[model samples]
Structures are given as C-alpha cells and as structure tokens.
Target chain A: MQYSNTIAILGANSEIGELIANKIAGNYPLLLVDQSEEKLYQLKQLVTEHHPKAQIELAVCSKDASWEADTIIIAANEAAEQASIASKIVEVTTCKTVIQIKKAHLDSATLHPMLPYSKFIAVDWANTTAIVEGKDENSLSITGEIVHMCGLKPLFKKSLI
Target chain B: MFEVFFSQVKDKVLLSEAEQKLVKTFFSPKKIRKRQYLLQEGNICRHLAFVEKGLLRSYNVDDKGIEHMIHFAWEGWWMADMLSFLSIEPSTYHIDAIEDSELLLISRPDFEEMLLKVPVMERYFRILFQNNIISKERRLISSISNSAEEKFIHLSATNPELIKRIPQQLVASYLGITPETLSRIKNKLNKNVPNT
Candidate 1:
C-alpha cells in the first residue's frame, strides 16, 4: 500500500490544534481527527477559510477510527488523554515522533515502558503560540517549518535523537 | 544542615570565604512542620527556600479541588513559585513540608543583592535554572507521554528511594494519576514482577 504525503492532526478541534493545522494548511494534504465529527467539520470550514485550495479530510478518534496517513500529530485535551490517544495512534501506525502539542504542562519525562520508541516530542505549544503573538515572524516561521518537517519525514528514519 | 546547601553552591561556583559569608548573611533559617504550608495560593511567594533537611512538595489545587503536584524538593533543592517570587503576583501553587524540615530562605531583595554582591553566584544560579529547565522539560514529557503503570515503573527503576519515602497519594499526584490508579498499578506490579 502506498501512503501519500498525508498528515493527520488528531484533536484538530482544539484551539491549539486548529492553529497548528492552519499554519501547515495549503502546504500539504491533511487528515483532521478529533473526538467529535461536528467539531472537525467546524475546523474544516475554518481551515478552508484560510487555505481555500488545501485538501483536508476528517476522522474522529473512536475505537474504530484509523488514519491512512503518513504522520499523526496528537493535540489532546490534557496530558493523561494525550498519553491514551498516543498509544492508540501507535497501534495503527509506526509513525515517528507523535508530537504531543500541549497548551500548558508543568513538567514531564519519557514514556519508557509504553511504546518504548524515542519517537516522541513533548512540545510546549503555548510558548510557540507566544512567539506567534510576539510578532517574531522569523522565529515563528522557523518553528512552523520544523513542525512541518516532522510531518514530512517519518520520525524513525530521521533519527537525530 | 547548611553543609548540604554550601556544597550545592560550591559545586556550581567556588565562593571565597568572605563571599560565602555574605551569601549566608542574606539568608535566614526557618523550620516547618510536616503538612505545614510555607507558601499558599493567592499569597505572594516571598522567599526562595533552600531545603537543608527533610522534604517538601509544591502543588496546586485545580477547579475540581484535586491537588496536582508540581514537584517534591528534598535536601539541596530550592522551592518557590519563581513567577510569584519574581513578579510579585499571587501564587498559583502551595509549598508545604512533607517532613519536618529546615530551610534557608532568601527574600527576592536579598537574593538579588547576593547576586549583585557576589557576582560569581550568577554562574551558580544560571546552572541551577538550566538544570531546572531540563528537569521541568523531562517532567512535562513524562506526564503526558507515559501511562500510570509506566510512570510507576519508571520511578521505581530510577528513584526507588523516592517511592519508599513518599506516601502513595502524593506519589500518584506526582505521577499525574489518581490514588486508586496508583494502588492498582502497585497491585499489578506485585503480581507480574517479583518484589525486588
């Protein structure tokens, strides 16, 4: 089976997830997944509003939900939920670095026993958003490009860890 | 007790005898009983407390009134809401003693004065902050990435002593799991793995 250059954004209904999707839209074909189909529809409209030509599909993160995409980004409601959804994502794809983009988190380490791959990055997306608000366009673009890179490349192949 | 504190500083930046004395002059020692709060939510954090003996924990009660732990500071660790202490804003967290503890606290003014007087301390503080950032980053990843059982296993493998010392409830909070979840994890471990 040939997987296209499709990027899946889990929890796409989230505010941070939307921002992330909006940033990367038009640049690539997208698959947006969340807890609710209704919310994903709203986000699809929003993404279309910004990138009229961008190809975007949708899925909800239910037990039966699966993505036929190359990469998946998890933007869960909370850390606990993030971990749960991540393990589920791993069950379907050997996709690298399921980046958990969180709004605010105190501190965290690695998932050793669970999916013991070094293909995970716990990003403080709030700080990245702050950069966007601060109008540091260059820095924001660099970060945006880096996140895009994560989507473009399988995490395991580009093992720089 | 202050030996631990001095060693921590000296490890980072070698202080002259006189500069060391100046550093000591800025701090005043205090004792806290177990379960006594050193700083509370809505109160401006005044001093950066350097733990000399015993243990302390920092946490916040969320909207559901569930306590979510921020950290556990033992000997040689510093406890303070850096935002509150620096900005003079109301603290979002509470710091309390987990064991009868001794601390050497320096107010913001004194801490600043020490940094100014003994400029070498700048190196030490910079190292301290860097380590804190690294630790905090690790914690953020671990909290969001690992399962309750995985977290317990990670802690048990890395810092078994911490598990032995801390109560189950607080350990659950630190691991970002419920107390019942923690008990379940321990039960699962007991059954699956041989007790080491």
Candidate 2:
C-alpha cells in the first residue's frame, strides 16, 4: 500500500516513540497520540525545538489519530497495550500500514490477527540495524523505507510468524 | 534538452555514449514559468535540479517577511536545498524560477542509482560539491568583512552577467546590501570610469 505523508504514533510518550518521532519529524507530518496529554505536548515541544519546521499534531484518541493518518506506528511498550491500541483503530486502519515496534523477545505475529485488514510490519529497533518483518514484500519494503527514514539500517527478515 | 547537462558532465569527466544514455534515463526534464516555485520553505526538497536554460534563485524569508538571497543557479548550474535533500528535512529556503526555465531533475534515489551505475560521475559531483563549499565560504567572508562598495565591485568583477541580467534590487539582496546603497555605489563607480 502507498503510504501517505502523515504518520500517527500511538504511544507518543514512550522513549522509542519519541526517538522515532524526532528522527522522522522533518520528513513527514506527525500525528502524536497518547493517553497523557502533557507528555504528548512535551514530545511536540522537544521535536519542534530541534526541527522548527516540523508539523506535529497531538491527539488523545487513537481512533481519531489513526483515522487521519495513512501509516500507524504502535510504540506502546507492553504487548497488551499495543493490542489494545490496534483493536481501537482496526476499523480506521483498513488497507493502511501498521508498524509495531516490538521487543526482540516479543512474538511478531501477535498483532496480525487483531488487525487483519491492515498491512502489518513488526520492527525490532535494535541499536544499529533494525530487523523488519512482514507477511508480504510490499509491506516489508515500505517498513524498511520508514526504518531507513528514521536513520536506522533496516535488515529485512522473512517472517517466520 | 539534455545537451547542456551532458556538456557539463563531459567538462568534468569523460562519459561513454552508453553511460550518457543511462544517465539521461535517470533525470526528468521539466519546464517552470518565471516566478514559479520549485521548492517551498516548509517542504522537503526531493529533487536536485540542474538548470538547462534560464535562471533560479534560492532565498530565506525572515520573521519580518524580508527576503535574504542565498544562491542563484544560472545555465548549467545545479540547485537544491542540500541539507533538506540529503537529510530528508524540510527546507529553510524557497527556490523559485527567476526566468522561464527548463530544468533536468533527478530524485535522491535516482541520483544514488545513477552514481552507482556510472561511477565516473562521482568525481564530477565531488568537484561540484567542493567548489560549492569554497564559494559559500568566500561569500560568508565577503558578507562579514567587506565594505558595501567593495562587495559591489567584487560581485561585478566575478559575475558581470549577474549584474546585467538580474534586477538591481535582487543583486543588492544577494550582496546583503540595500537597493539604495547599490544604486549609490553604481552611480559613484560610473562617475569615476574614464569616457571611451
């Protein structure tokens, strides 16, 4: 699927979320969504301070943010929280790219069943090279592009999920 | 349409006919009207544009909406927000056509692919980038240390065509001087010149 210019980060307050946001802030418009409004605003301030031209919007509702964004990034630390966010935005994310930043130990296939309509790509954001895995080559390549845009080398791994 | 580009490349490095054809395939030719914007300040600069004909200028808008000229691309010269293009960031400067222009544009991916496919072009880019840096350094020094009249004289000596082709107001902005000062300098210089 062709990705749009706007990207939504579900857990904008998380470390990984902020890191990814800061890296891609200049390239794409961002819709930052998180439960904590204060943390989301703080992230916006930090990103805008570094990238003065960065276009950032904050949202407390995951569904509304995901609905507006063509690409959704689930940066929630807990697998349950990621799954919960996916479930809330499932209807809005049909045929869209949903990238989940998962831990090395986490099962990559866990979110696929929840958002069957969306193209899912699991990213293991390692220190240097990020391992990107998806069911199809299209989504894998798209995810790899985004990973590269975030200043990480993407190593594509065939999904064993 | 690509004759100018091919000539510029040949001046730096010899290219085989086959390699030239390969390089040609990477760029798309575009025509822009005078005053048309090639890039806006808030947008990412996706392409590196080489001027085939006419002129283009890059400038920054201050908080008070005054424009500060940055650079100009004449025939055979290349233009882009280098920082935005390489880093995939939003551009701080806007690039616009000063005259109706024909340009050859290559996106970042194609630019990389072309370099890998035609490695000789790498030397060409190295020289181009080196010269660009040197020019920027000189401009920076000139802006900081040179007197207004000295700056005008230096610009006339280096780029006589710019003084003739561009408007007095824009030339003054590029030299970081007011248009009135530029007019005064021109009048003073013309008075000192011996009659033919």
Candidate 3:
C-alpha cells in the first residue's frame, strides 16, 4: 500500500528503477540506493527537477546488509544473479513488505505506468497484482492486503524456500 | 493406501452411511501396468482418479513434441486436470501409470451429484485446492528464479517424499531443467553427502 515514512529502491540507477522511483517520489520518503554515486546524484536531480517538492535521499552504495522501511520496491536488473541477490536483500530487510517489479517473473503488459510521472501527489499503487511469498500464512496475507490497499493486485503464493 | 484414504476422507467430512455408500458405488477399482496410459490426449478425461496404490504422472506434450511432466500423484493423492474433467472438452494432457498401480475412479456427473449429496465435500475440496495452488505456485517461482542447482536443493528440501517416489527426469521437467542437469546435480549432491 503506502510506505508511511520511508521507501527504499534498490538498483536505483537502472532505467526501470529510476522510472518507478520518480513516479512515487511525491508520495513517500524516497531513498535511492545505487552503486554509482554519480548516477545516484543524477537520479536525485532528475526526480527533483521533475517534482521539485519531492523529498529524496541518495545513498551512493548500499553497504548496509539490512534496510528498514515500511515498504520496499525492488526494480532491479533482470539478470538471474541480480534477481537472486535482490531476493536475499528482501530476506534481510526489516521492511514489512517488499514489492518486486521486475520483468523476469512478470509479463510487461501488467505494468501500470505513472510511477515515473506523478509529483507532490497521492501515488495510489492499488490494483497491482503482487505475487506474495513468505514463511507464514499470516505474513503472506498481511503483505498481500497491504499491496491490495495500494491498488495492486496481490497474488499470494507461498515461497518454496 | 486405501485404508489411509478412507480414514482421511471419513475423518475430514461428515457423511451418512447412505451418502458414503452412494459415493463408493461409483468408484471402480482399476489396475494399471507400468508405463501405460491412464488418459491420453484428444480423449475426454471422464474420470476423477484417486490413487489407491502406486504412482501416476500427468504430462503434456509441448510443441516440440517433448513430454513435460506436470505432476506425479502417488498413493493417497488425487490427480486430474480440473478444466478438462469439469468440461466436456478433449484433454490436451496425458496421464500414465508410472508404476504398477491401483486406482478408484468416479465419473463426472456422479462425482458432482456426490458433492451435492455430501455437502462437507465442498470444504474438503476447497482446502485441497488451496494446497494444490500453493504447491504449484512454489514450483513456478522456483522455475522462474532459482538456478538448476538451487532448484534441486529447494525441491529436495521441500519434497523429500516426492524425490523418493518420482524419477529424476520427471523431477527435472517439473523444475524446468534438463535431465542431464539433474543428473549432474544429483552426482554433486551424492559426492557432498558424508556417507552413502
């Protein structure tokens, strides 16, 4: 649903990641994490330029093993290895729910545009179907309902791991 | 296996003697030789089969004509394509006996009537569908993101009973990997295990 205070984006410099970040910049506290400091700064500039009132934070490289956020979105690269690492990052994060908006597991037709456009706005993400997997059924349902509130459809699936 | 199935069904659903007897009347015991087709493509899947003994597999032939195994239903398991069995359409999937087997089958209309007669069966099937969906989703995610080696580990960890019953190749197909890869992974696992 809505990340009340903090929202973290991994692989922030990537095109898709940046686009998603720009779209949600006005709604929540946006933190962009990328390995490239220059690119991170550029992303910040781009978001600020488009949505001047957007509250944005730039982390040059995410050295922290675990990040804390109410909600996290991983719009990283589509490489298998990258996906694996992103999964691990999600496992380690303190975030209650993690939304993975990657092309690897999903068809691009499901993408709801506007995350990269809205500024100083009520970014409603409800209507997105998130495939949720977790250790406990309660946790899985909780995460799914949160996404459901954001206008995102949540496909709750128990994880194999 | 029949004893277990009977106990499970009896314990889970409340059925009167008459309703239970009616349900049992449609069940025809069938013996299948190993590697024989239970239901083949282009044929109507007329029965909902319950595994009373041994193992069976339901598979689909891809465009390349390769058989991709969908599921292996062992003793005490139920296997069928819900869409095909519910509809009068010809089935695209094939189900075959993987081992010498025994099954109890019920026809479509009869089973539906039984469902109406035994209302508690709706709950039983609802839970069964939930469990089925959960397992399929797990397998789907493993196929999409996990590496071949990771998939083997994950599968072995999650479904040790399945690994014991189903052949390695079918397991590979379910994991979306080649048999050769499965063999290599198994070999690696064997070498890594401390003893035997």
Candidate 4:
C-alpha cells in the first residue's frame, strides 16, 4: 500500500497533540479527529494563530466516517482506554506510533517539542521506553519506523508469550 | 543461529537482498573468554557487538564502586553502551562476557559507512534504536510505578528464563529491588507453590 507523509492526530484538539500536529502539519497533511466540534474549531483557530499556512482539517467522530489519512496518531490521554479508537485505526490507517500520555503509564523517551523546534520539551514521550508486544517482526518494524520518523526512540523486546 | 538472528531482524526492518549481504559481511566472528571485557569504561565503544553465542553484560560502576547492571545479552541479543556508541564519547559502562561468548562485531565507522552505502540500513538502525528506546522507557515506568512484588511477578511472567539464568543480584538490579527483598519474594513464591 502507498503511504504518504500525512499524519492524522486522532485526538487533535488536545493541547499537546495540537502542538505536535502544528509542528508536522506544515510539511505533511494533518487531519485532526476529535469528539467535540467546539474543540475542533478552537484547534483550527489555534493552528491558524501560529501557523496560518498550515493545511489543517477537523473531523468529528460523531459525524460520518471521514478519516482518510495514511498515518493515524492517537495523541490524547482520554483515547488511551478507547479500544474502539485503537481497533478502528488498526483497521484503516497505518499508525506509526500511538503516543498515549496518560497519568498511569507515561512514555517519555521519544519526545519532540513544538515551535522553535530546537528546544527539547521536557516530556515523558522520549524518556519512556516502549515494550513492544507483537506477533510478527514486520508489525514491530512498521510501528518502530513510525516512532522514529516522529523523532522518538523505540526498543524491541519479545512478548511474554 | 545467525539465520535466526537475521530472521528476527528481517521481520522488523526492510532491507534489499544486496543490503542484507552487505550487513552479513560485517559479521566478524570473535570469541570472548569468560570475564573478558569487550569494551571498558572510559574507552569509546567503537563497535556494536551482536551475540552469536554465550552470555554477556553491560554495567555501570557508581561512585560507591557498586556496579549497576544495565542489561544482559544472551544468545541472539544486542548489547552496547548506546549513549557512548551514538555520541562517540568515552563509555561509562563496561561490557563483559559473563560466560565465554562469541560475537559479530561492527565498528562505529564501518556501521555508519555501511548505512551510507545502503540507506535502507539507516531506516533499520533508526527502527532498532526506537525499539530499544521503547523497551527502556517501559521498564523504567514499570519499575517506578509497580511495587517490588508486582515487579517480581511481572519479571517472572515475562522473562522466566532470564530469572533462571541470570544471577540474583543482576535480576534484583534490573527489577530495581534489593537483593534481600528479591530473596524474600522468591521464598514467598516457593512457599506458595505446592510441595511437588
């Protein structure tokens, strides 16, 4: 399958996710999938506030199925527990990395800062290690490549099984 | 064994046939005697050593002269001082053969040269680094958040073979638990199991 540099932020309305989206949105297509229309509107405004040239679009889950991006990135903490979101993205888009910044399990190893691009944001993303539990090596590699492209580090280990 | 390692790698990173051959060329066979140091502290780690046989460990010595076990490289595992390897700085950790070992060593310059020769290798190494980063992040999170008992259970469930093979002290260090605590936990587990 042909995959583009386009990255979809599953929870784009998120404060940090928006910042992340804004950074990559300039170069590639940025699709924001969120639950709230108001938040989506606010995110669009936020993107325009800093990046007026950014090609940002808002898609609500409440609406019909319209997410058509090559890569899907789940960026919100709330979506971490959403099995539906995970399963849906797994079915459609090719997710490179699922950045779950939940309070319970924070991964800070592969962190990338927004704006001024050089300043390293103190995030758990880069510091947290990934324990990949997958059946095949191709699956792990695909996921690993996505994280690397996002400028995050990842490590591979076999599953308990 | 090399085939097995390559099989594991081929699954994650996509490399062309020619690119794969170039990588296979870097696999220089070397045997390390038990207790021998492949790379020492204060020396730049010039090579990324992949295990072909036997066991090895990478460890850091603290100010108190206590060695903190970073990781163990069993058969078919990769071990290196990543901070030192990537930065080309003097390594603080020492990689030693825990058991008489065999490895395929590739120097940093050769590895980078190989990557340049084959750009797909850059993608492979990038993914490799990411995978390592992910595992480290997960281990740190689990160690900090989970209780000692919980960590033991997790380790036992995940790497029972490692628990059996590695020394208790190293396992304790990996789990971020005291040796005494690990002993106690093991005893508790032993007592809980039926006397068969």
Candidate 5:
C-alpha cells in the first residue's frame, strides 16, 4: 500500500510515453523527461487535465529525471537514442529499475553493460497485457506491480540479459 | 511528549483524565534528526504527526530540483499530506524535519479508533480541519494577489518566530521569491524602522 517509488518516463513526448503517463497518473508522482521542453509541457498539461491531482513534473534532460526518480522508463523508439541516454544516466540509474518499451530487435542486454547496476525490464505493451522481460526476480516482480498499477496485466519472460 | 498535544486538544474540547489517557494510547512518540524525512514524495503518508518540539516542513520539488515549501509545522502543530493519508495514495509532498524534532504520530486506523473511543475528539479534529481550510484559503489568496514585499510582511506579522528560526533561503522559498529578493526586502524594511 505504501507505493514509494517515483517514476521517470524518458522520451515523454513519444506516443508510448504519453500512454504510460496517462495510465499511471494519480497513482504515482511522475517525472516526465524529454529533449523538447514545449512537448514536455504539453504532455504535462494533457496528463494534469485528465488527472487533476496527479503529481507531475517536467524535465528537459534525462540526467535530471534519472537522478531524482527511483524508476526510469525508457520510451524512446530508436535503439541508438536509448543507448545514448543509457550512457548519460549511468551514474544516477544505479540499483534502479529501468523499464524499456521494447521495439524492433533491440535487446535489453545491449543496455545492460552501460547500466550494469540498474534492474532492466523490457515491457512489450499489448492491448491489455504487457510482456515483461527481466533477469532479476525481485526487479521483475516490482515491474509487474508497476505494470499492474498502469492497468496492464504483466506476463513475465525470463531474459538471458 | 504528549503535553503539547494534550494542550492543543484541550484548547478545542474538554477531555476527562480517562479520555486523555485513552488518547495517549493511540499515538507513538518519535524523534527525527534535522533534515530527516518523515514522508517522501511518492510515499503514502501512513501517519499524521503532531509536533512536540522543533520544526518540520512539507515541500514539493520541481523538475529543476527546486523545493517549494508548502507548510511548516512548529510546536503544537500537525503535519501530514492529508489527501494521501485519507486516500492511501502516494503523496506529492515531502515532509521532513527542518530542526531536530520530537513528534507524536498516529496512524490512520488508530486515529479512527481513537475518535470512536473518545467521541469528543471528533469535534476537536473538525475544528482543526476548519482552521486548516481557512489558512489554506488565505495562503492561496495571498499567493495570487499579494506582492513579494506584502507576502514577506504578512508572513513576518503572522509568524515572526518562524522567520527567525528557519533559514532565510527556506523563508524565500516559502514566500515564492529569490533569496536575494528576500534579503533586499529585509534590508529595506530594517532601514524604514524609525530609530529612537
């Protein structure tokens, strides 16, 4: 009942990020991070308009978001951009849950080295069920809780990464 | 530890010795070091705390990592993110001890039980809630309509002891102005004071 984790959604301007933000609004305090300040503000407005009591903050950079949040959701579509973000937030993301919205052939393993201490979980968001992939059981369970909070049923997949 | 709490309750409603003893059973005593957190943002506010000694503050951190002070709880005051405590949801505000503090904390269930067992507590809490709402409304109006100087003056007039106890930086944050601006205002006010 004591949900103490603050979640940061990187690439908050992305469609998936916005979807996740809307789903999780009012349940947890959010740090929405994006390169575009204007887009971040607009996304914040949309989220707050629907869930007026939602605790939402906007960040123009990933470092600021990752530093403050206990969990990080990487919603960036491109693998290259995700890699760049991973490198940038390496220090702050230690021992934190890093949830990636899986796309294409990108493996959570590729990001594992850069964020070695971080618990990585890849969420493949389906219509109603989310396929969650992770190596650590504890991290997987935490991710499941978060996915459940977002109104999605979590289907676990053990990852070799 | 319960002296401050008992006095505050007595101010609102009369309680017998038996009722006071029953009230004491519901609360647990705690001591928090300065800068220690009672409740952090994103955590559910499990307990409502009444200050016995020292000060605590509730604040919100923005995306830029700036803290915006929402409220301060001094001796005989209570602190909690009430919405989170009532709804059992994650809180947006962080409550922390601004000075080394002693507090009496009661969990939501215990609070309810105490009110039921000691029915007079309902009136006491209702009066507290009403006063809290009025204070919040006044703060909201001031933030919207008052100038920085006016805000500082009002705060000084209302809670001058608080201004002296807390750091000026925090005072500036509470007033929603820059520290330099607050310093300038203080200097200007001091200059206007007529010498004997």
Candidate 6:
C-alpha cells in the first residue's frame, strides 16, 4: 500500500517512471506529472482501468514540486533533473517524505521532522515496491518479504534500509 | 597490474595464486589522460573501471547546461554507472579522469566470467558493495539533513583526504552547493571554529 495522503510521481512520461506508477497507483491517490499532458491522461486512464479504487489526477511536468503530497517519487532517468526536482520538493514541501526512484548510491531518509523533506532514494526499485506492498513496519521483515517476492534466497545480504 | 586488486580481495577473502591470476586475466589495464572521458552521456557504459591510481569523476549536465558532480573515485575506488552497467542502457552520467590515471577495466561479459571462474570473488564484490552502500547512506544522511557549513565540517573531519585531493569547486558541486557558498562556509569555519 502507498502513503495516506497524496503521492505525486514526477516524470510520468518516462519509462521507469511509468513502471513505478503502475506498481504504486493501486494504493494511493496519485498526481501524475509529465512533460506531455496526453501521456499523463493515457496513464491515468490505464491506471484507473487496472485500479478502479485509485484516485488519479494528471498535470503537466514542472521543475518545482509545488503540489501538496505526502510522498514524492522522482523516477526520472536524468540524474540532474532528479536532484533539481528533489531540491525543489525539499524547498516547498512541509514535512513530506520524498523518495528518489532512480539508481543512486544511497538509501536516504533525512532525520529532521521540522525540516522540509525526508528523502529516501529507493534504488532497489522492485524490492522497494514489494516491501511497500507488504506494509510490514520492520525493515528487516520487509527485506525478507522482498526476497520471497523475488523468489530468491537472501544470500547473506545484510541490513536493508 | 593486479597487485592493488589482489590486496583488496585478500582483505575480504583469501585467493590462491591461480584464482588471482584468473581474476587478473579478466580485467584489462588502461591509462586515461586528464580531462579524457572514460564514459559519456547517451552512450552505453561498457566497463566498470577501478582506479589503480589517480582520480576519476562522474557528473551530469542539467537542463541549463550546468554541470553537477555526482561522484569521485580515487585510488582503490570504483567508478561506473550501475544502471547503465547492469542494464546496458545509455548512461545519464559521464565519467572522466580528473588526473592522468591508471585503471583496470572489466567489461560486462568478462566480469560475469570472472565471477564464475573465481567463486570467491562474489564475497569480494559483496563486501565492496556493502561498504559502498554504508558510505552512501551516511553521505545521504549528512547531505540532506545538515547545513552547508555542517556538511563541510563533517566531510573535513571524516574524509579530509577527499577535500585535500579534489578541488573546492568539485567539492562544492558534490555537496550540492555553489563554490561561493562553500568558500563562505569554510571562511566561517576558519573564524568561529579552530583547527578547521
């Protein structure tokens, strides 16, 4: 399941972003943003058909993450754009959790609650989706769920974040 | 050619001479000139390069054509676009030599072959990835939560070698701050905090 409030997915036109939206659109009220309005509408239609319960909205992409969202996913392939979007989100959002969905070095959630964004780079995208679906509070347990979801052994992997 | 890598592998798991030789056979050595690119944006990253000596930096250009530094790999470090390396897609990042460097390059096929040939290498890479993950997590925490001055101070305390080796501009870029901001932060640190 997704977060309680609105979850905005930036770069909805991109392939990876579209894939992530497909995985996550079922559970959350999604605000899909992309460069093309037509593409966003198509995605919204597809997602709504697949997930009738999902509340979805479409908007054209902008550099700023100005909308109110509890969680934000910058799934764009461009690393520079991701940083810019993330920083913009951090600047505008009030105590929101921002998750970067591209391949990055880190898995981060900023510590301060008062400060704007608590960011997490969910680099392991498939496992991240699996873990989120389980909604198991424990991270370790989520890793186990992810391993089970992938149908693979843990193979001595440690300390999933 | 393989001495530095063999030493690293030895630290994690023991490798016999034959195993070491097999591993070495998979990696080819290359010398990169300063400012010469090893990988470019829009091109598939063919090899994961390990720095036997000198420095390499991975970066990207933004919409306004502004360059942002993503990572730096000095001696004993690895530099590659993991997404591109694993998926064989066009890299969003470019890697270039900061200094005239010696590197050991392992192509995708050769890397897979090496893993099969030397089963113990799995442990070596796992440990390396683990270390990378830990540092990245720590870095992300600091970079996100802390102020520029605080970030600079923490970086100086922990990885002084990085600040010493890399230029202030690149350091500022890596920290997601402007050079002027970094300079101001350092100035403030020098004034308020002793031994900065």
CA deviation > 4 Å runs, candidate 5: A1-161
Off by over 4 Å in 1: A1-161, B194-196
Q: Report i-RMS for every model.
A: 24.7, 12.6, 24.1, 19.2, 12.2, 20.2
In angstroms, the error of model 1 at B74 is 1.4
- Weakest ten-residue segment in model 4 chain B by summed lDDT: B24-33
TM-score of the B chain in each candidate versus the native B chain = 0.92, 0.98, 0.89, 0.88, 0.98, 0.95
Predicted candidate 6 versus true structure: per-residue lDDT over A9-95, tens digit per residue: 888777766765676665666778877888888888887887888877776644233343545666666766666566655433432
**lDDT for each residue of candidate 1 in B35-118, tens digit (9 for 90 to 100):** 767888988887898988889998999999999988888888898999888889999998888998877777686688889999
RMSD in angstroms between candidate 2 and the native structure over all alpha carbons: 13.4
List-wise, what DockQ does each model earn? 0.01, 0.02, 0.01, 0.01, 0.05, 0.01
Tens-place lDDT digits, model 2, residues B83-119: 9999998889999999988777777877898899999
* True lDDT of residue A36, candidate 5: 89
Worst 10 residues of 6 chain A by lDDT: A130-139
Compared with the true structure, model 3 gives a TM-score of 0.51
Backbone atom clashes (below 3 Å) for every candidate = 9, 0, 12, 31, 0, 0
- A112-157, model 1: which lDDT tens digit per residue? 2343331344445543232111122332343446454434321211
Q: Which candidate is the best by DockQ?
A: 5
Question: What overall lDDT goes with each candidate model?
Answer: 0.69, 0.84, 0.65, 0.63, 0.84, 0.68
Error of 2 at A6 (Å): 20
| lDDT by residue (tens digit), candidate 3, B9-95 | 776666677766555654544555587677888877878878878898889999999889888888788977776887778888889
Q: For residues A69-145, write the lDDT of model 5, one tens digit per residue.
A: 76899888677888888988876664467887875445533577787657788788776788999887877987898
| CAPRI rating of model 6 | incorrect
Q: Estimate, for each residue in B68-154, the C-alpha lDDT of model 6 and write its tens digit.
A: 998999878889998898988899998998998777777787789888889999888999899989998999999889998888889
Q: Which stretches in model 4 have alpha-carbon errors above 4 Å?
A: A1-161, B14-17, B194-196
